[model samples]
Target: MRILRFRAFTRPGDPTSGNPAGVVLDAESLSDADMLGIAADLGFSETAFLSAIEPDAARVRYFTPRAEIAFCGHATIASGVALAREGAGSTVAFTTNAGVVPVAVSPERATLTAVETSVEPLGGVLLAELLDALRLETTDLDPMLPPAFIRGGNPHPLVPVAAGVLGRLDHDADAVLRLQDRKGWDGTIPVVHRISADRFASRNPFPRGGIREDPATGSAAAGLGAYLRQHGLVTMPAEVTVEQGAETGRPSSILVSIPPEGRIRVTGSAETL
Candidate 1:
């Protein structure tokens, strides 16, 4: 049982700053409980297990320290890069619980295609609760972009805040977890500020998955792409960049591309650690 650790979404020339994920290439022999135990032992936000289903295609499962999630973008990127390093070809199709995520690999980076994404309205009551949980007031939120429940590979309630407020995202872990569960969100994505029409800064608090925060969240990035496109926040055929992990001092970036009509593409670099 060889477990490989890789740092996903690392900044160029800075391997130490990225999101870490565990990859188990030969996971066919491992059961669900075994995967859960391994993820808990590693203590990463998510770990990916791969089982060969066909040539250039594999069945991948994602598990957090506490439970299994439907999808994980960073882990998928890490696994695809791992497979490419092992001669799996330039492209791999991952049959995930959410959907089939196709990843295109290159020597320098990997790009993952997300599932269908949607942006739905956030209820008034839930929005208030979420604001309270994060210790934010309505005035602190971005005036142009109201909060909404964005669903890509997973569920994220994205709240856009004013400038200078995203750096102070501190709250009770238990209370935040409770709020996520109650609102049926996998995590809360508080976008600190929009640097430009094509770039933004964000922080994702994922207490429900037994993690305090994610340095880089690919799924959330994809979700945000969908939100921005749907709301006309950015121009069509948009390519957006999300800056994350700076608050944790592990700065990382995720590139998201939203086409005319299809799954969004999230790209990033990974390094073996």
Candidate 2:
């Protein structure tokens, strides 16, 4: 029952700045209740439980303090790095509840290929509800990248805000939880601001996970890459850098690469904690 802790999505030379996640290398004998308890006890936003490990593939489950989720980007990165440190090789396929996610691990970083991504326009009513819940107005949104629903592994309502407005994002936890319940969003609601053509800043509110905000969110970064590609916001085969968690003092850097067509790739460095 040993738990390995790692900080995923960190910058070079700074191991302490990233999202922390707990990983259970062997969870075959653990039940759902046990996993939930461990996740809650760990107090990380999400944790990874690995079982049925093969040479290059393993079955993995993600759990937050509140409940189980289909997928988690930071925890997956942490798990990949943990396995790599344990001599699992450079590449591994993780079979999650969402889908099969392939990870390439290195001593410095890990890159994960997300599941098939999809984007859809957000309905007016739903958008209005979300805005009301988050205490935002239409003027606060960036017109170039309109609000939409994006899915890489999990679903997120992508809210693109104007520069400087992202720092002012505030919402009641209960209000956001109610919106998540109605919208079936299992992931965070990412409020992003474009810093440049290939750089962005984001703040993710994850009330459904029993967290007010997440410092680094790899899954939401994947979803953002899909949104940019689908809406023609960025050219094909583009590389984007996302800066998140500064508000939380974690200051994580997430690198996302969008190919012409296929799953998006999220890359970041991880360090054992």
Candidate 3:
């Protein structure tokens, strides 16, 4: 029943930033209730439970304080580093509820190739509802990156905000929860602003997970990469950096690599806490 904690997506030499996640190395005997209780007690946004299925493969499950999630990027990164530290080798395959994710671990960082990604335009009615919940106006949106439902592992509504509007993102918890329930969304709603061709700032609200916001969201970043590629916003085989958690004072940087065609790669460093 040992629980390990790690801060994922942290910058070099600084462990104070990034998102904290819990990892249970041997979770084969733990029931769903036990995992849920552990996640709730840990109070991290997400925790990963791993059961080794082979020397370099394992079945991983993710849980938040409120419910189980199909996939979690930060927790996966943390688990990868943790497993590597435990002599699991440099590469490990994690079979999550979403799909099989392969991670390449190093002493300094870990890179995870996410499952297949897809993006589709969001309906105007749903977009309006989402804007109302986030206390944002249509004018605040970036005309270039329209609202879309992006899925890397889990699905989230990507709302691209205009410059200077990202810092002012505020959402009603109750309203967001209601929308999430109605829409059957398990992930956060990300409001992003482009800083440059390859850089962006983002804030993700996770009312469905009983969290106000996520400091660094790797899954959302992967989805964003797919969206950018699908919309011809970025050139093929490009790398994008997403800066997040500034509003919460736990600034984190998530790097995503988009290939010409295939799974997106999300890379970050993690430190044990």
RMSD of each: 1.3, 1.1, 1.0
Candidates sorted on lDDT, descending: 3, 2, 1
Poorly placed runs, candidate 2 (over 4 Å): none
Q: Rank the candidates by TM-score, best first.
A: 3, 2, 1
C-alpha TM-score for every candidate: 0.96, 0.97, 0.98
lDDT of 1 by residue, 1-273 (tens): 579998888899885678889988889999999999999999998999999745589999999998889999889889988888878877889999999999997645799999999999975988888788887888889898878888878899888888888878786678789887776666445555798888899988888877888888999999899988888888789898899998777788899999977889999999888
TM-score, predicted candidate 1 vs. hidden true structure: 0.96
Q: After superposition, how far is residue 35 of candidate 3 from its true place, in Å?
A: 0.4
- Indicate the worst ten consecutive residues by lDDT in candidate 1: 183-192
- Give the Å error, residue 270, model 3: 0.2
lDDT of 1 at 180: 75
Clashing pairs in 2: none
The residue-by-residue lDDT of candidate 3 on 69-187, one tens digit each, is 99999998898888888777778899999999999987557899999999999967889999999999999999888899999888999999998898777799899999998888998
Rate residue 14 of model 3 by lDDT.
Answer: 69
